[model samples]
Target chain A: MELFTPDFGLIFWMFLSFAVLFFILWKFAWPAITKMIDQRAELIDKGVEYAQQARQDLDQAQAKAEEVMQEARRQQADILREADRVKTQIIEEARGEARQAAAKELDQAKLQIDQARKEAEQNIRDEVSAFALNIAQKVVRNQMSDTKAQTQLVDSLLDEIEKKN
Target chain B: MKRLTLIALLLISTLVSMSFPAAASTKGEDHGGEEKIDPKEIIFEHLGDRYGWEVPFCHHKSIPLPIIVFGSDGLHIFSSARVEHGKEYVDGGKIFRIAAEGDFKGKIVEIVDGEETRPFDISITKNVFALILTVIVVCLVLLPLRCYYRRKGYKAPRRWLGAVEALTAFIYDGVIKSTLKDKASKFAPYLLTVFYFIFVMNLMGLMVVFPGGANLTGNIAVTLVLAILTFLVTNIFGTKHYWKEIFWPDVPLWLKFPLPIMPIIEIFGVFTKPAALTVRLFANMMGGHMIVIVLTLLIFIFAQMGMAVAGGTAVISTMFSIFMLLIDVLVSFIQAYVFTMLSTIFISLAQENPHKEHGAAEAKH
Candidate 1:
């Protein structure tokens, strides 16, 4: 029974001692220890949060860069398509102009050839007439080297002229 | 591992055999019908509070402490050596003697003329000395820690500082943070003090080192005070909803209004919690100490019988004592953990918002 019994004086001393110890520790020891630990924990949490924010920022920048790159590619494709359209348009216009010029040149050449042929034919007709006239004169001269033929030709011409008159 | 085991086996067998011869030699000197060993006395003596620290395995006298007695007259102060192992001490009109074979047996009593009275003994007893030593040790350990933290600030703790820092962090993280949550920082200091105080006392009790063998935590009064403090801390800062949950729980109104049984039960629960805490710590430490002492006494009990019996039982009793001591070492740490863990839980429970929890439950339903 004595083994388990509690002494009043012992309890008092224990209480007083415990209270003193508790107060001393609570006031001094625990504050510094807990403060350091809390500061460290807060610092770590902040670091993790900063790292996560940085990662998110990097992802955003990467996505923005990708978007800009895509925009530039799209614009470049549009320019390339426009250039091809213009090239084809220019080529077609040039071909049409060349065809028109070629047709006009062909018409001019045909007209010139027709005029040259006509001139040559006229010249040939004049020469043939002149030659025929010379040949007739020669023949007349040769034949009318006989005056009678000449006189007869003239008289017949005169008689025909009188009859006509 | 194998070699170690073989060595241990050989050593044990040698000790066992050697004890037989030793017992035989002692037996030759013994007269017929030797008195039997009193295990109960030995165990009780080990567990009981003393005026001094007994240095085990030594023939020299125990280190005496101061004896302080507050009686009907006034305070009486003197060296415990004056009492001479509680035989008798006389000073003026006061008489002090060891009460034997009574309710106050093993206690120092005051004899006034013919009447016997127990003085209010607030002496520097073995347990008190140990507790004071523990406080000094705690301060010594924490002073260095406090300085290290002051110098280093937020840097990682190193060396002995690191070991202590780890223990502190473990308590903060495991007990305070887990239980107290938002209020963890507020209660951290108290929690740390409780943990270290209890743990140091328990470890000292197990080791039987300087201020170690004194079972301070095993004293019921000390534990009661500790529990009461926890009780006060919990109830004083208890939230409005904490009180509501106890008084008017989110149950049917009839239970609260008509019966009022729940509130009464809840009020009783408050005292029981701390009471349980007190008993749990005291019983565990006291029981562990008792078992170890009892196991040790078994060797002597057998030895008192005869040489053969003594030798045979020494090995078994010694083995049992060793085993019990090992368990005690583990128990000391465990009890410390349990006390701190429960304290944190109790304080946190008091701080809980019962209304919010009730609303959450209603939402779930």
Candidate 2:
């Protein structure tokens, strides 16, 4: 019963102390602590969110770089193929022109050779007839100088002519 | 760390000074006679309030405090030292003495015509002094932190600030947050103050010597006020649903219709919680101190009985007292934790939405 009995003095003191403490703490201490904790958490969350966005941006940039590289590679292949085609076409045109010029030159040389051979054949014919005519005039002059020889030659000629007639 | 070491040195110096005076007085009194050790006197004196902080083992040397009394004569104030121990003193028209042999024994009272007159004793007692000291220590530990917080709202805490921050965060996260859920931040300051106050007092009580010893939490008046504060806080912030559940509980219709039996029980339940809080804290703390005192008393009891028994008892008593002191340290921490935990739980229960249960059941169906 004595223990249960309240001491008003102690109660008054405890209440006064507690009230002052609670007021000062609530005013200055707790608010600062809680706010700082909350602000720190928010800052950490923001940092993590920013890091995640940066990682995503890095991935997007890498993908764009790969796309550009692939496009460049494809364009390079097309350019190389067009260059190979042009080179082959130029080589073919050069070969075709050389073949046509060689064929024309061969044809002209063949005509000139044909004309030279005909002219030589005519000149040989003429020289050979003139020699034969000289040889016949010499034979006529020898035969007139020698009548008998000439008559013999004439008789032989007449006989060959009569036989022909 | 440095400050704590300084405080430790101060406490040690005070203990040394206290013992020297006590030893000198006891030696002087030894030639007169052997003092008969009364265990009850030791226990009760330790538990009860004092007008002055008694220097351990010393007679006629105590730190007197101010006494404030309210009576038919309005208010009277004086130094408690004015009232001689076990003797009466006449001051102006009133005689003040310490009651020594009755129901009001150990109390400071006003004597009129040889009868003890009951004037309202609203003086600064041992417990009041302790409470004041606790406030000073708390303010000393916390007020300096305002500067650090004022500069940066939320950076890393260091030194004493770090220690206080950890404790505050623990109360916020562990007890208040776990109990109150959403309203934890709203009630954090009150709960944190209560926790630190009780913890400091509990630890101070464990000191058991002048300038440090004051069984503040063990004192029923102190615990009562604390419990009452918890009670007021719970009921004041109680929601409509809380009141509904208490007055018109969701019980069987017959239980409600007959005489509001459940409501009566529920309403009674409200006072019982704080009552339990008051008694539990009071009894545990008081009991711990009593056990330690009694264990030490064994040595004196055996000394009075026989020389051989006293010699053996001193060793056993010292060992048991040491063990009890260790347990007292642990008990102080546990009791503080329990009180704060229960207070938070009570407040949270008062704010609980009673309809949420029925809503959940309906949803499940």
For model 1, the DockQ equals 0.45
Considering the true interface contacts (CA pairs under 8 Å between chains A and B), give the fraction that model 1 also has: 0.70
Model 1 stretches with alpha carbons more than 4 Å out: A49-165, B9-33, B305-309, B359-365
TM-score of each: 0.74, 0.76
lDDT of 2 at B293: 80
Model 2 ranges off by over 4 Å: A42-165, B1-31, B56-59, B305-312, B358-365
lDDT of 1 by residue, B1-365 (tens): 99997689557845864564466446535645545556777677778788777775442378888888876688888777777655788766788876775666766778876777888888888888888887878887776888887887778988899999888888888879977788998888877888888988888888755557887788898898889889999999899988988898877888889889889988998999999999999999999988877766666666656667776677666677678888888888888889999888888878877545854345324
Best by DockQ: 2
Colliding residue pairs in candidate 2 = none
Candidate 2 residue lDDT tens string, B170-204 = 77778888777779887877887888888888888
Counting only residues 3 or more apart in sequence or on different chains, how many pairs clash (N, Cα, C under 3 Å) in candidate 1?
A: 0
Interface RMSD of each: 1.3, 1.6
User: How far is A85's C-alpha from truth in model 2 (Å)?
Assistant: 6.2
